[model samples]
Target: MMQNTALMPGSRWKDPAFWMLAPATLFILLVFVYPFVDGLILSFRPMNGGGALANYITFFTDPHLWKTIGTTMSLALPATLINVGIAVPLAYRLRHKTRYQKIATTIMTIPLTLGTVLIAQGMLSYFGPNGWFSQLVQALHLYDGPVRLTHNYWGVLISLVISGFPFVFLLVLSYITGIDPGLPRAAATLGANPYRQFRHIIFPLLLPGLAMSFCLSFVQAFSVFPSAVLLGSPAGPTRVISIAAYEAAFENYDYSMASAIAMIMGVVQLGVVVVVLGARRLAYRGPVTGGKG
Candidate 1:
C-alpha cells in the first residue's frame, strides 16, 4: 500500500491540505486565541498593583454587581428554552417538503439578516409603550393603557427570541432532515403513534443536535449588550454581564477590572454550556448491538 500522504515524514510538507489549513490556523492564533490569552492575563492584573484575584474578590464581594449573574441567567435560559421549544416542533412539522416551505423559511430567517441593533430599533418603534403593538392591545382593551414591552426585561427577552429562533430552527430542521425518513415511516407502519414514534425513533437521534443548538443560542443570549441597553433597563433588571464589562472598561476606563469581568462572563457561559452538554449524556444514542440489521 502507498504510504499515507498526510503521515509520511518528508513528503507531508508537500501536502496541499497542510498549506490550506495553515492560513486558517495562523488566523485563529492571531485573531482569536491571542486576544483571549491577552485578556486572560490582563484579568489577573489588579487595579492597584495587588494580586490577580483582587478584581475577582471585588466582583464577588459586591452584591449588586454579583446579582447581574442571576439577571443574565434568568434572561438567557428562558430565551434559549423558548427558542428550542418552538424550533423543535416547527422543525418536525417542516421536515417534509411543502409549497410554503421556502417562503416560511425565508420569513423566519429575516431576523438573521438584520443586526441586533436594527431589531432593537424596530422593537422600540413598533413594540414600545406608545407603539403599534401596545396601541393595538390598548385599543382592544387588553390592558388599561399601552402595554410596556420595551426598555425592560421583557424587551430584551423578545429581542433574544426574535434573533435566536431562526438559528435554532435552522439547526434543528437540518438535524431532523438528516434522520432516515424511512425509520419514522417504518415505526408508523408498525402501528406506533406520533408521540411514540418520536420518543422512540426521532428524539434520541435529535438529542445531540438540540443540545448543541441550546448551547449556541444560550451563548448568543448571554452576550446581550445592545438590546439590554436600547430596549431594556441596563441599570436595573436587564443589566447583563456584557454591560458590566462595558461599563468597567469604557465608562470607568479600567482595563484590568474590565478584563476580569470579561473573564467571568466567559466562565459563566462555559459553565452553562458544559452543564447542557453533560445532560446530553443521559440521552439515548442508539442500539448497542453491531449493525446486524
Candidate 2:
C-alpha cells in the first residue's frame, strides 16, 4: 500500500513522480493559467478611467456578441459532430486492423501542418469561383456562375472539419487501441453478432475518448480565425467571438475589452468540456479495467 501522502511536507512535491510533473506545471502556469488570470483581472478594469463592470457589460449586453455566438455554434456544432462522427468510424477501422494505419494517420494529419491560413489559400486556389474548380464547372456548364464555396460559413466549416477530423481520429484511435482485444472476443464467443458486439462491447469503452475528441474539436472550431477571416466574411455571417476579440484588441486597441472577450472564451470552452465529460458519464457503456490492456 502507498504511504499517507498528505502527512509529509514534501511527499508529493519532492517525489520523483511529482517532480516529473514540474515542467508541465510550470509550463501551464507560465503560458495558460497565468495569462488567463491576468486577462481575467484586466477584463474588469476600464480603459479610460472607471473601475465598474463596463468592459464586461459591453460584451455581455451586446446583441452582436449573442449573434456571434450563434454563428460560432452554427459552424462549431456541426463541424465537431461531423469530425467526431467520421473520426470514430475511421478510428475503429484502423484499430489493430491495418498495418499501414500509422502511415494513413500521418497522411491524414498533413492538413494540420498546413495551418488555417495556408489551407484557406489552398481552398481559394482550388475552390474559388475563378479558380480551377470554377473553370471546370464553367467548361462543363455545371452552373450559371461560379460556385461560391469561399467567403462564407460553408468555407469555414469545411476547413474546420478537414483540419479537425484527423485530430479526433487519432485521439479516438489511441483510446480504441487501448481496449482489450479479449473483450470483443468474449462477446463474440457468447454469440454476439458483430453489430451487437460493437454496440455493447466496443462503444462503451470509447466514451471517454469521444468526450475528449468532442471537447478538443469544439474548442478548435470555436477559436477558429484564419478560416473565418480568409475563407469567410468574419464580420458578416461567420463573425465568431475570436474575430471579435481580435478586432477589439489589435485593430481597435481595446486591450481591456479584448481581455474580457478572452476571459469569456476560456470560460465558455471550460463549460463545454465539463458538459461533454458529464454527458459521457451519463452515456458511457464500457467495461472497467484495472490496468492498460
Candidate 3:
C-alpha cells in the first residue's frame, strides 16, 4: 500500500524539488510579475501633471487613439478566422504520415522559419507596385496603372496569414493526430459519409483545440508591430494599438498614456480568450478523453 506521508515541519524547505523551482519562480517574479505590476501602477498616473485618470481619459476621449482598437480588431479578427479555417482542413489532411504530408508540412512551415520583420520586408519588395505581380497585371491590361499592394491593409493581412497560419496548423495538427484513428474508422463502419463522420466525430473533438488556436493566433495578430509598420498603412488604416502605444511613449514622451494603452491591449486579448473558451465549453459536452479506440 502507498503510504501518505505527512511532511515534517521545515521538510518542505529541505525538498530538492522546491530548491529546483526556486530560481525559476524568482526569475518569473522579477521579469514578468514585477514589470507588469509596475506598468499597472504607472498606467494610472498623470502624464503631464493632471488627475490619476488623465491618461485613460485622454485615450478614451481622443478619436485617433481610440480608433486604433477598431483597426486592430479589424485586422486581427479576420486574419485569425482565416488562419484557423485554413489550418483545420490542412491539419486534418496531414494527420496521417505519408510522403505527401511530409512535403506539404515542410512547405507550409517555411513561413515559420522566417521572422515577421523578414516576412514584411519580402512582401514589400515582392508585392510592391513595380514587383513581378504588378508588372504582370499591368502587362495583362488588368489595370491602367500599378496596383497599390504593399504599404496598405492587404499587405498587412497577407503578412499575418503567412506568419500566423503555420502556428495554427501545427497546433491543430497535434490535436488531430492525438485523436484515436479508430474513432473515424468506426464512424465509417457505421455507414457515415465523410461529411457526417467529420461533423459528428472530428469537429466535436477539435473544437476545444480550435478555440485555443484561435485565441493564440488572435493575440499574436493583435500584437503585430513590425509587419504593420513595414507592410501596412500604419499612419492610416492599419495603425494598431501597439503603434499607438509606441507613439505615446517614444514620440509623445507620455509613458503613462503608453502604459494605459498597453494595459488595455492586454485586457482586450484576455477578454477574447475568455469569451472563446467559454463558448467552447458551451459547444462541447463530450467525455473529456477521446476513447482509446
- Among the numbered candidates, top lDDT falls to 3
What digit string (tens of lDDT, one per residue) describes model 1 on residues 47-106? Answer: 787687989999999887788899999999999999999999989988887856677688
User: What TM-score quantifies how close candidate 1 is to the native fold?
Assistant: 0.94
**Comparing candidate 2 with candidate 3, which one achieves the higher lDDT?**
3
TM-score per candidate, chains pooled: 0.94, 0.90, 0.94
TM-score for predicted model 3 compared with the true structure: 0.94
Q: After superposition, how far is residue 199 of candidate 3 from its true place, in Å?
A: 0.9
> Which regions of candidate 1 fall more than 4 Å away from where they truly are?
1-9, 288-293
Candidate 2 lDDT score at position 123:
91
How many angstroms is residue 71 displaced in model 2 relative to the true structure, after the best TM-score fit? 1.3
lDDT of 3 by residue, 1-293 (tens): 76544466777787898989999999999999999999999999876868888888888899999999999999999999999999999888888988887897788788889889889888777799998889999999999898878888998999999999989998998888888888889989989998997888888888878898999999999999998999988899999999999998999898988999999999999999999999998987768455423
Error of 1 at 168 (Å): 0.8
> Per-residue CA lDDT of candidate 2, range 1-293, in tens?
87787677777766887778889999999999898888888888879756658887787789887567778878988999999899888788888867689787889778878877888889999988888888888889878888888999888889888888888888888888898888889889989998887787778777777788899889998988889999999779999989989989999898998898888877888888999999888885544543237
Better of 1 and 2 by TM-score: 1
Worst 10 residues of 3 by lDDT: 284-293
